[model samples]
Target: MFGGVTIGEFARLTHLSVRTLRRYHESGLLAPATVDPDSGYRYYTADQIPTAQVIHQLRELDVPLADVAKILATEDAEERAGLAGEHLRRLEAELARTRAAVLSLRRLLRPHDDTLRVELRKIAARTVAGIEDVVAQDDVLSWYDEAMAELDAAIESRPLGPPGGRYANELFTDGRGTVLVYRPVADPPVRGRVHPVHLPPSELAVVVHPGPHDDIGVTYGRLGAWVVDHALAVDGPVHETYLVGPRDTPDPAAWRTEIGWPVFRLAVTDVMPGKNPGQTGNPPP
Candidate 1:
């Protein structure tokens, strides 16, 4: 005790509580300078003041206790900086998501009466020459770039139809993204690694998106609402028929994607089925 500082006095000087100091000792983060054998009392020297203050600053930055212990165990400057840099990137991504949510809420609250035009259309079957892949939703953008490059090399003539995306059942429920590119032509070859998928006949609730793909979620919500109002339910994954893409159109403002929700006629009857003797569809036990 160079400055005559006891454990309690040292905690006050370092802006740390007595309980916290004791916990740090147990965690091997910071240990006291001296300890009594028989009395079991703890004491600290003035030189340990800087160590206590450093721990205080680190805890204030939201660093986990385990990570703080690792930082103290290693003396490598580069490794410590690397950990901090990774945490900073995660914080930035979280902030961006929070900002996007705020903007969406603001858009919903604004007064507007721009009614969306709902159309029921039948899509004809056409041959497309492009690449297809199963991609994770988070990595879909990068996958699209690679697939487009393959399409450009495989196809001799330029794409006649728009670039589009096809979703499978697992896409929405499990976050699995399946994308397919289509080019219109007669008797397209289905050889090499390309797989041919036929477009099924069904009633589709179609809406034309007139801008970029940034806020496509807004259009999806509006279309679903329309389908609900008409007592129509979608039984399949949604499909986006891109009328314009980077290869066909240079201006993003002119880009168009025909978003279609597959739906069918609901058969309503005034008949009810008899309950089984042992099973009455009761709530689970």
Candidate 2:
């Protein structure tokens, strides 16, 4: 081996454990320059020190082993840099989410009035430009961003009202279902996935969920409890109005999402003998 160094000496030079170096060698991530077939000992050359250092830096960034292999296997400088750039972008997004979570936790730890204000309102039927799809739960966030972008690009004008979405219960309970996102617009131009459609009028038990959606589920639970207490629950999809959202402001505290649950007054006799009085007994999709 050129400028030969034993495995132990190489590990010391790289500031990595001998065991870790061995593991990396077995994974083909950082193989030594030479191996003694008789003694099963690994040897490294001084020239391989930079490679070891690069591998260590990548592992510190939590890049997957497979990705590390891909990066090392590519000899093109631009391709290697592109792979690292892509991973850095993912790390930035994860950091943003972590910061948002910390902010949400601070609010949850503080004491304040926990009361929820709900209103009963009739929403008139209206025509909208939108897109509908059966999206997997895991893909919802990215799908929503693309769908909204398409809608925004197609309209080329301000929407008449805040954007809204209809979520079928199966989307949550079964992990995959239909989702419709729309912007209220008059005579919107149909382009790409954007098309004109009419929404039905319905009475909704609505409540405002403030702050980042990280804890919006808590608001949903509170609203459901309020519906059951008021005997106004019904069978239908959930609706959401993004009054002030990520697109509106960077401050989580300024964000507002209106959660609407379908409801109708139930008579004493209308209550099923064995079923929940607040339930409409609509079958799940």
Candidate 3:
């Protein structure tokens, strides 16, 4: 007998409801100290207060019930520490996602009254020496890292400029795509996927995207719409030239990518002003 405090009295003392206490009993996490068989009532002792408080704190932190039971049952300090640490890491990741979303929302709320600048320019032919791969869209990031690492390993000298570029083509409409990575250099290796692919000189509608690659799609969409608004049409797949990719630049905000949509110049004004042909621009609010 926990100094003979009934379930109702224990709930009041612990700031927990009687229903919650019954649930704890059913889950066997915080069982009552005594049971009155004749009345089918549960009673808790004052001595059980510590255990009840621990359960309450864990629940407040949104710990899983099973995990709370495991923590309470485990006598080893190291195991409990590891469990808590793992949960903390998960919580931190969730916080990071929330923060990113909030920042994106703030950008969206700002005025878009000013017309986005779009210019047509001829890109000169350039030689880029780097590893290339036909990577699936889902595995593109890993493929990018691996290709860059391979280039780094085989190179006698690193590219004298920014990390370089990724050329993407719509191989599969839904989720699959092929992307090629190229770095500016005089000569590249002959083995593996490392072969010379000439980038033809073309007139491109260019927009500078300064931020993480995660949100470049938003910029792409906006630029595409701007091009359409000006009566232009993209005639080919888009190109992304990373002037400051992750390997070369650590800060995401410092990363600059020139998002280019190859276009055929047009003079028609009949195209709808608000229609977004390339939903790649600043992310949807």
Q: What total of clashing residue pairs does each candidate reach?
A: 1, 0, 13
lDDT of 1 by residue, 1-285 (tens): 233467788888888999999988888888777677776668888878877886777777677788777776767889977876666677766776676576556656767545666676667765566567787877776777776676656566555566666676676668886667655544455656454556666667788877666566777888888777555678776878878766667887788888988876453121123433233211111
lDDT of 2 at 9: 97
Q: Give the whole-model CA lDDT for all candidates, comma-separated.
A: 0.69, 0.84, 0.73
Tens-digit lDDT track of model 2 for 49-153: 888989989999999999999999999999999999999999998987787677667656767454677777788888899899999987888899999999988
Report the lDDT of model 3 for residue 152. Answer: 68
Best candidate according to lDDT? 2
- Greater TM-score among 1 and 3 belongs to 3
Provide the lowest-lDDT 10-residue window in model 1: 276-285
Point out where model 1 deviates above 4 Å: 1-103, 190-192, 248-251, 267-285
TM-score of 3: 0.63
Error of model 2, residue 114, in angstroms:
3.1
Clashing pairs in 1: 128-183
lDDT of 3 by residue, 1-285 (tens): 335788989999989899988988999899887787788788888888888888888887788999999898988989987887777787876876677677667666788755555556688877666566566676776788888777666656566565555455563355565576776666765656566667778778888888786566567768877876667777766777777768666898888888888877665334544646444431221
Give the range where candidate 3 is weakest over 10 consecutive residues by summed lDDT: 276-285
Error of 3 at 39 (Å): 11
lDDT of 2 at 136: 95
State the lDDT at 3 in candidate 3: 51
Give the winner by lDDT: 1 or 2.
Answer: 2
